[model samples]
Target: MESHVVKIVDIQQVTHDVKSFRLEKPAGYTFVPGQATEVAINKEGWQNERRPFTFTSLNHEPTLQFTIKRYADHDGVTNQIHQLVAGDELILHDVWGAIEYKGPGYFIAGGAGITPFIAILRQLHRDNQLAGNTLFFSNKTAADVIYEKELSNMLGKNAHYILSREQKAGYENGIINADYLRSQATDFSKHFYVCGPDKMIADINAALEKLGASADNVVFEK
Candidate 1:
């Protein structure tokens, strides 16, 4: 496998705990919207500690972007990654086959899982193919929603926000179960894109199947 050492170009604080890092795109290092590559910081004591991160940037863009959520408790890779600056360097490996866009449908994401869908939705919006897509983003609180403004701008009223722990004025409450899906989803045959923790993915996929979505029509990190 080959590797590329790239320099960070910019960093933006997306949410309270999430960050967007823009990095130099190595020549010929193209990746699909939902693909990811193993990444490691180039600083001492961290060169070989690689973790997979989804590319949130479009394939045709000159720079690469990664939206990452920091885990202060873990004190591991993400914590160290959050401390990186614009002049820092990172090592990236070849891209891996991850989630892919398969036409318009409902996109369901939990917490940091929204990273992959960001690229897909952006690409679709740029191509003028975002009309039929719906986004259902679930989080613990209002502050945990990443790219809230951007998603709402791109999706308009199709963007749904659900809070499992907090009940806000306009956001929906309760978990996304079969009953909730059956009530909200108008078309059962549409493709379902689900991403998040393994348990959440399994539960949502099962619920989608129960609500008449076919297993083959479900797109995930499998």
Candidate 2:
């Protein structure tokens, strides 16, 4: 497999636990919105610890960006990634992903799963096709919501924030299930894009299926 060692140009804290890494794009390297690649930190003893991360930056952008959340619970790749800074190097593999924008639909994401939709929504907003799309982002708390300001500005009232563990004044307090989906969505026939933990995805997909949505119309990472 082809791999490129790219240098990190910049790093910014996106949320309390999430960080955005802007890496120097390799010439001729390109990927569609919502696509992802295997990434490994170019450090001793960690060079082969590759993990899949979605590109949050648009394909046309000069820099490739990855919006990653650091999981400090275990001594793992994400924990290692949080220690890196600008000028650090990373090994990136070929781009491949199952999630792609098919059309305007409901975008359901959980926590860091919002990474894939970042590029897709940005591309849509850039192309003036953000209408008819709605985003349902569910996180543990307000501090866990990544790109809140940017998402609000870009999506306007179409964005819905749900806090599973904290009930903020402006956000909804609950999980995204059949009840929630049925309450907010009027058209079950429309496409539904979902990305999250495996259980959440399975539950949401099953709920959508039971809510009169066609199985083929639901898009997700498969």
Candidate 3:
């Protein structure tokens, strides 16, 4: 696999734990929205510790961006990433993902899972094709929601936020189960994009299937 070393140009905190890192885009490097590449910090002893991260920047953008959530509880790559700043370098491997956009439909994401849809939704917004899509984003609390303002501006009333831990006005409360999905979306025939933790993905997939959605219509990382 080919790898390119890119320098971090800037870093912006998107949430309490999520940070967006903008890196130098390599020459001739290209990727479709929703695809991700394996990334490793260009540091001794950590150069081989590659982790998959989705691209949050558009292809036309001069720099590549990754919105990552740090798990400080564990001594992991993301924790290391949170400590990086401008002038740091990272190695990016080949881009690959299966969460491509098929059509305007419901996008169900949990916490950091929203990273993959960031680029895809941004592209759709830029092209003025974001009208038919609806995003059902669930987080533990309002503070945990990433790009909340941007997503709301992009999708308007289509941006739905559900808080699983906190109950607040203007946000739905509870987990996104089969009943929740059924209440929010009536059409199970439309395409569904889901991403999150392994268990969340599995549960959502089963819920979608139980709601009469065909397995072929659901798009997710396999």
- Candidate that would win on lDDT: 3
Whichever of 1 and 2 has more TM-score, that candidate is 2
Better of 2 and 3 by lDDT: 3
lDDT per model vs. reference: 0.92, 0.94, 0.95
For candidate 1, which ten residues in a row score worst on lDDT? 174-183
lDDT of 2 at 154: 94
Candidate 1 lDDT by residue in tens digits, 95-196: 997899888799999989999899999999999999899999989999999999999999999999999999899899987778888888999788899999
Two-way TM-score contest, 1 vs 3, winner = 3
Q: Compared with the true structure, what per-residue lDDT tens digits does model 3 show for residues 111-197?
A: 999999999999999999987799999999999999999999899999999999999999999999999998999789999999998
> Using alpha carbons, what is the TM-score of model 2?
0.98
Poorest 10 consecutive residues of model 3 by lDDT? 95-104
Clash count of each predicted structure: 0, 0, 0
TM-score for candidate 3 = 0.99
Tens-place lDDT per residue, model 2, 1-222, is 999999999999888889999999999999999999999999999999999999999988899999999999998999998899899999999999759888888999999889999999999999999999999999999999999999999999999999999988999999999999999997887889999999999999999988999998899999
Clashing pairs in 1: none
